[model samples]
Target chain A: MTYCVAMKLDSGMVFASDSRTNAGIDNISKFGKMRVFTRVGQRVIVTLSAGNLSITQSALNLLEQRARTNPDALGIWNAISLYDIAGLLGEAMREVKNRDGEFLRQNNIDASASFIVGGQIAGETQRLFQVYSEGNFIEASLETPYFQIGEIKYGKPIIDRILTPATDLTEATQCTLVSFDSTMRSNVSVGLPIDLLVYRNDSLSVDIQQRIEDGDPYFSQLATRWSEGLRGVFVNLPKPDWLTPKI
Target chain B: MTYCVAMKLDSGMVFASDSRTNAGIDNISKFGKMRVFTRVGQRVIVTLSAGNLSITQSALNLLEQRARTNPDALGIWNAISLYDIAGLLGEAMREVKNRDGEFLRQNNIDASASFIVGGQIAGETQRLFQVYSEGNFIEASLETPYFQIGEIKYGKPIIDRILTPATDLTEATQCTLVSFDSTMRSNVSVGLPIDLLVYRNDSLSVDIQQRIEDGDPYFSQLATRWSEGLRGVFVNLPKPDWLTPKI
Candidate 1:
């Protein structure tokens, strides 16, 4: 399982994805799911994918091959808009599935994969899109400024409460990590070594990118402090007056 | 859809269930999912249900009729332990499914249902059990102190963070309400009025019972206060120093 969240805030964009893949419990392995495409100072496209590793890897490989072999092919690096890049990624997914999906189905393995594709091009504002397994997609808007894919439910309530279009990059990153922490605690399939990238709007390049593994100082402090703060808040929440019986 | 949660705590037990049901988006209605059976000062058995409402209702009706018509039939009131009552409930579920499963399947509707049965008889200690649709059940223990059914994932994180066998009844109730609040916020299928019951361990009778509808004062206060408190904690979370460029 994967838990990747991306927010298209007014200030910038925040992307985080876990690095765990498993064919089954015994065959679990670490595979970073964040794919970064950049033409430095021109465009930066980040894709976080979930589902069958083979399918997603194949789809990404196809996109990368296209960009590298043919610069004028209108792929990730040269796309006019984030929306066009998202379309290319979805088409790549269909191409890969059409090649391998039948073989996977014969072996009773699910062949579907999805992606949270978001970033900025030279002329366009930062945008976020979640591409479905069927090669269809939807873009995030002001009303829904964030998109989460894979193992989303356990960590959804917090994001639903704290995120908005006007939220700053730093705060959105904090919220995304908190959401990841909640997910990792509840589910074993979503493990550590998160790939995090923060894109300041209009920069047209990536600045802050780090892989967060176990015992990272700031993440550790934030997680422990958040837990402690929640317990503190819970203890102070007023006990229902009706819980006590009049003697 | 429905959301019901029950915890087996050392101080007693807490059961809370939403009152919303829907055949489809346009066919939503309110029907209390909680049923209480008490032989005052002797036994208090509570059943909270989820899944196909018709199947669960029919199963409960069968149990009620059996207990009422034949005092010597060894039904819920005279069951040796809560375990026996859980088995009875599971058996009732199987009977109802066997009767209605064919028709529902023909129409492509699910015929499955489940129940969280908990409480005590005169000779037994407090207990909780989650009866599955297959007529199998598992009892809650010190390690696993709670059970939730239907629309459960959105509300699961808070309970995972806070609930324990050692938690007091009031605190457990608060946690359950917070969980319900999270669920209702994220999904429209689960909503008020919530039927809440708190049972004091070994009392063998229920004292506090309330149908908390919309505009209920304490619930409203808690929900609003919880959201505010979470925002407070999020702001206080320290931003990573790495986010800043060394000037």
Candidate 2:
């Protein structure tokens, strides 16, 4: 299980992913689930994956191999638009699924995986997409300005409350980390260090990519303060008038 | 889909359930999921249900008929402890599954269902149990003092943050509603009017059973204030020092 979230705001985009993966409770390990691709001044594409490690690793390996061996051919590096990049990712996922889906399914394993891929590509506006295991995708819209993959529900409420297309990059970063904190608390499978990247719209370069390890001062402070603040707010909320008297 | 949660605290117990039921997105209806049985001053047992509506309704019907038709049959009404009540409920559920499970399975429908049953019988202290589809059940312990059934993840973080065995009944009730609020906001399948009941320790009577209808004043106020307070806390948190300067 993993928890990854990405937001495409008017000011920029934010991407975050946890580094925990488990085959079972006793067979847990750490793996970075985010991939960053950069062509400074031209493109800055970030991808956060969730699902079978083998399948995503295979898909990512295929993309990287294509870029390395055939730079002249169309690949993530030369894709004219973010849509093309998402399509390439979807194709890679489908290729891997076609190869591995049956073997895993025979053993009653889930072969499905998903990715939140988004960034700017020189000529167009920054866009975000949630690519499915079936080689299809949907872009985020004003009505839904973010995409989340894997162990997503525990962290969803806060994102639903705070994020919008107009949210600033820094505030969105704060919200995303708080979301991760809530997820890490409720679920042990999603642990630190968190890989986070904040992209400024039109910058076409990765400026802030921070890995929040255990005991990292700022993340520790933010988690503690968010928890304290939530409690403070809850205790101060007006109790039900009827129940308050009885208590 | 549904969202139902029940908590057993040192002060008492709190139970809540959303009323939305759907065969599919287009085939939606409302049915209260919380049922209370009270023999004032002697016993007060509450049951919250989730999963196949037909199965739970049939099981509840079976329990009601047994208690009404044969008082000497050791039914819910005569159960010596809340555990006995939970067992009776489980037996009824098993009977329903035996009758309905095969047919539902033949059509590829899920026959599983679960219940959170709790209350106090005369000589016993209040206890809570989560009865599974197979009729086996587990009692809530001091460490895990609550049970949630159906669409649970979105609302779980707040409860994990605030609840403890020592939490008071009013605060638990408040916490429960906020959880429901979070679930309802994120998943439309779980909706109001919410059915909520608060039971005080050793009080063998139903004191607070609230149906938070759409536009219910207190719930509306709580939801509004909570959203505002969360945003307030979020903005006030110290931004990550490194990112703050860049933004």
Candidate 3:
């Protein structure tokens, strides 16, 4: 199980991903799920993945191998637009499926993997897309400012309440962390260290990419403050007076 | 789909269930998932169910019929302890499975159902049990004060943050509503016209059982207030100040 989310906001895009992966509880391991492809002044692409780690890793490794061996061949750095980059990533996923899908099916394992690919090319606006297991993809729009993959429900309510196309990058980043905090508390499958990246619109380069661990000071403070704030608000809300006597 | 949760607190118990049932998204209908069995001066048993409405309704109907015709047949009213009532409910589930499971399986349908039963019997302390599709059940303890069935994840974080053995009945009731509200907002499958029941220990009767509708003034106000409160708290929290502009 995993939890990864990306938001395309007015100011920029925010991406967050949990690092835990497990075939079973006893097989749990930490693997960084965020990949950054940067070409200094030309483009910056961030990809967050979830599902069968082997499949995602294989697809990613194939993409990285292409970039290293043949920079012009379906590499994130060489893609002209975010859509082209999404297509290239999808092609990579399909390549992996062709190679490993049959073996996984024979072993009764699903050849499942998904990804959120978002970034900006030198001349294009920042955009985000959610890539499916079959390599199909959907881009975020005004109506849906955010996309979440894996164990999404526990952390969704907050995003649904607060996210919009006009939301600022900083607020969206905070909201994403709060969302991750909520999920981390309720679900053991989604653990730290969290990979968080914020891209400023039109920067065409990585802005802030930080790792949040279990004892990270800022995250710890945010969690405590959020919990206290909720309790305070809860107490302040008016109790149903009609049920007072009965209760 | 349905969402029903029941909690056993030190002070008493709380049970809440949404009233939506759907064969498919377009075939949605309203059906109460909660049933109250109270032989007034004797026992007050509340059962909240979720999944496969037909199967759950059949199980409840069977329990009701048994209690009506064979008054001494170890029904909820005749059960000496809450544990006995739980056993009776589990047996009812098994009976329904025996009658319908094969036919359902043949049609490629799952005979899925779950229940949360909580109440006070004349002689024992208030108790709560979560009964599964297999007719097996587990009781809630001090460490885990609540049990939720069907579309549960969207509403789980709030309960995880707030529920405790010492939480008062009113606070617990409020927490449950907030949780349900979150679930409803995130999931179209779980909807309005929620049924909320509150029981006070040794009261020997329902303290409050209310149906909250879509336009219910109090609920609408609570929802708006909570949303505003959350936004306010979020804005006040410190933003990540990690990235400084290069000199």
Clashing pairs in 1: none
Error of 2 at A199 (Å): 0.7
Candidate 1's displacement at residue A235, Å, is: 0.8
Arrange candidates by TM-score, descending: 2, 1, 3
lDDT of 1: 0.91
> Which parts of model 1 are misplaced by more than 4 Å?
none
Off by over 4 Å in 2: none
- Cα lDDT tens digits, model 2, A91-201, are 999999999999999999888899999999999999999998787999999999999999999999999999988888888999999999999988999999899999998
lDDT of 3 by residue, A154-231 (tens): 889999998998888777888999999999999998999999998888887788889999899999888899999998
**Decreasing DockQ order of the candidates:** 2, 3, 1
For TM-score, the strongest prediction is 2
lDDT values, one for every candidate: 0.91, 0.93, 0.89
Query: What TM-score, to 2 decimals, does candidate 2 have?
Result: 0.98
**Backbone clashes in model 2, listed as residue pairs:** none
